[model samples]
Target chain A: MSWARPLVLGRLVRLAWLLPLAAVGLFTLISLAPIDPVQAYVGDRTALVGSDQRAAIAAAWGLDRPATERFGAWLGGVAQGDLGRSITYDAPVSEVIARRVPASLALIGTAFVTSFVVGTGLGIAAATARGGVGDRILRSLAVVLSASPGFWIAILLIAVFAIALGWLPSCCAAPPGLTLAEVGIGDRLRHLVLPVATLSVVGTAPLILHTRQRLVVFLDGPAAQHLRAHGLTERRIAFGAGLRHAVGPALNLHLAGAGELFGGSVLAETVFAWPGLGQATARAATGADAPLLMGIGLSTLLLVFCGNLAADIAARIADPRLRHPRP
Target chain B: MTLRARDVGLSFAHPGTHPDHAPTRALEGISFDVAPGEVLGIAGSSGAGKSLIAAALAGILPPAALLDGGITLNGTPPSPRDIALAPQRLDALDPLATLGRQIRRLGGRRTDPAALLARVGLTARVARAYPHSLSGGMARRALLATALAGGAAWVVVDEPTVGLDPEAADRVMALLRALAEEGRGLVVISHDLPRLARIATRVLVLQDGRAVETAPAAAFAGDGTGLATAFARRLWQAQIEDPAC
Candidate 1:
């Protein structure tokens, strides 16, 4: 547990630098886009607005300023705990993010937990049956699922369960034009099913493949042999000694893959029209909502940093060698 | 009852990583026996298949290795649990487990971890340490202790004293000797022929995975005069005259 202290402090230091760097990077990338923020905000009314009105709008939003000046203003506001405002939504960036974060968390949290549990189980099964039919089938499934794009799978699920069978809604976190107060719990969960399943399938693939690969090596290693020699059955050795040995590497692999999982969630959100940070990010990127994008970018960097740190702490708990220095 | 490897042979697939590979013979025509209260020492230079023989005896051969003939106890194939192998590689110990927990797991709930560690000349504190925290010598002793704790009828120990200081090495040899004296069969594999000769009832010398000689321990006498094979004589002489000695 002592390892957690230094590990967390070190990550916090890295994160302090990462948040600003990510904000600047997102601001720069979004700035390079051809879409005009005022044009996006006004939509088809862009032609109706006169040059005078456009100039007033650009001045009001500070879009008329130099990129460096706008970035400096944004950074200064962030240092003072202000996240600026979303030009697209006509709301504070922080407020928009707060409203959307729970939706994203519900989606990513359910999907990620499912992926971890199911992927780890499948991986253990495959490794325990390495070179057998079950191993081959699981490995093949992992390959196909991992290689396919997340949105593609989302569309496929929508096609089968939503459009084809009409078993579930095709898209969106709630029925069109419905407020949170109007939607029932069952309806909300019904709307969630496809996207969560899609993200879970996408996230689970790499975990299964990685866990199986790492665990197979461990199952064939000296520790497994030692366990076998001690009179334990194969099943006992695989679940007992082999699982403990392989889990640390598998967890680290999963955490190292946080970037991909985040990227996949974005794709899933766009396809399913989920009202989450990912969907907001997509809309913000296209609408040239610099402030909103900056807020989301910083939040994402923070989430990923926290996730990796949590994984490090968990792995140390699993393997004591990681907790103490080699004597 | 005795532990026996009768005409036992082992061949691992070459280019082991590949699906299509040829079997490369590692050990063949290897035969020996260790009855209760007897110690059989297996000695050879590096790459002589000494460890392979130990793996064969313990029934922990790699999946790629094709084993021929048989290793038996009391005239039948023994269950894997009946043989305890303390592998040469320190990595064989469960890295995630404390020495005490692993001892309890292998030795059963009733077996006292501290008592077992003390028997191997380790402190009770050592039982609480993870494998990686131990020195190489400590790891080796810990491994031996775990093997002993298994309480297997047949114990196969590979290079049990490779990293130990002289005194610790002697202590390990004595502990193994005591096990044999207590009517447990042991197959002690080592490059330290001299130390092995001290306790081994019979020493089987291996060359390129084949047994070159199986002689009574007393045969490794002055100037290696009693050693039967010329190769065995030179091997004995070389160890005796080595600069390390």
Candidate 2:
């Protein structure tokens, strides 16, 4: 089959099935919950009063219908870029997401880039220095970072750097307050440090260890021996040939790690008081804000999908054999 | 240009001696030379140091082999680019790379792989195909193309036609002759004496890590009691008589 057809069709199939399934499952669970959506929104079950008042409120939000009908309506609204209204904020779900997404994107984007660059570089170094003191040091550091909880690390970092050293502001530091240009690059980066570092430290360990292990394995394979015999320099064989072969698996790990980053960032955001999706999701969950909760879930799903897609594209580029049958 | 291994002695040292597990003496006092434009075929039983001699000549013997002699190419130390060996196995080529690229790499030629493939009796279409995709004979030919592409003065070809059909073997033998005629020295290592006799100018018989006989191809055949017949007889006796006894 032609490449383009499979690529487009695969994505289309994922969107066609997965979105509806997620929406239906989420809507059903929200509907069946013991907490009343009206009470959850208004903070008073008694305000949803007489039979007429209850019917009007339910009708306005299509909650008066059967479960299946309500789910279908929600799915249809999603198709038209309407993610429904926030039961708590009384705003459009898309508007809330749009307002909040930039903060989360910026935070996650910085964290992702930092983790990949630092982690991959360290992994290569560790693999090259396998069985040496450098490898031992890196392995120990990776184990420690990987084992520590993101919240604990965040708190320790805040205590040491923010409270003790007074190197950065403790909490709720506005991006513009420390900048002359409304949002100076330095100010943004400084504000991003604690959260990004927390996420990177937590996320980087597995990546470093995975890349290092994969590199060592590739070096031991027959392909490496053949390359060595071809009169290629050892450096060329190791970094050029070996690294290229190991990238596919490393990239898959990277994508999976990126998905986990969203979940892990909740603690970091909560500790740092960073106004990102994880914090938003946590607050919405505590208050039983179903629409906001669903909004966060949908955005997280989209981020994961995009990350996996990027990894697939990278794999195809790195090894054309993935796209074409070996012949 | 000539390729020579002078009094080459290679031994593997063992920490403790056991009668059944003695240190292997792969090559011992081996001395031979391949003159320009000559095909020197070495025939030996397995563990007779045929491969060790080949590795010594190509300057690729393992560190554990422990050489106590000298190998030279045109009176100078062997450089990596000076020697090329068509390994015994056909899939010796990289599975990830195209046959043409491999040929270009081996040939050390800046020419297109299609041109190189043409020299190996393969069409230009074969250039993009990988080694795994080729037939046994085709893979051998591609390997030969790689070895010959480097334009090396000498090639240490180990069993060039091992698993090939008669036709493929003939083609490969013919290609080696053409390479020899182009003033390149060829070392054809194989047990198939008939095939070697067809191409070699001189034939050497290696037994127990020593050159037991060295003669011109015509002399070896004219003697009527050739190395080929002798080796065959030994193999038959080992397979038939020794097993029964």
Candidate 1 residue lDDT tens string, B1-245? 98988998888776636766568889989999999999999998889999988777777777778999878888999887788888998999888889998898887889899998987789999988888888887888899889988788788999998878778788789989998898889999998888899999999999998999999999987788999899888888988887653
| Per-residue lDDT of candidate 2, residues A36-95 (tens digit) | 665545555575476677677767766667878766776677788788887666789888
Q: Tell me each candidate's TM-score.
A: 0.92, 0.80
Fnat of each candidate: 0.88, 0.12
Please report how far candidate 2 places residue B239 from its true position, in Å.
12
Per lDDT, the best of the predicted structures is 1
Residue A159 in candidate 2 has what lDDT? 94
Local error of candidate 1 at residue A9 (angstroms): 1.3
Clashing residue pairs for model 2: B107-B149, B107-B150
How high a TM-score does candidate 2 get? Answer: 0.80
Docking class of 2: acceptable
DockQ of each: 0.71, 0.26
Q: Is the docking of candidate 1 incorrect, acceptable, medium or high quality?
A: medium
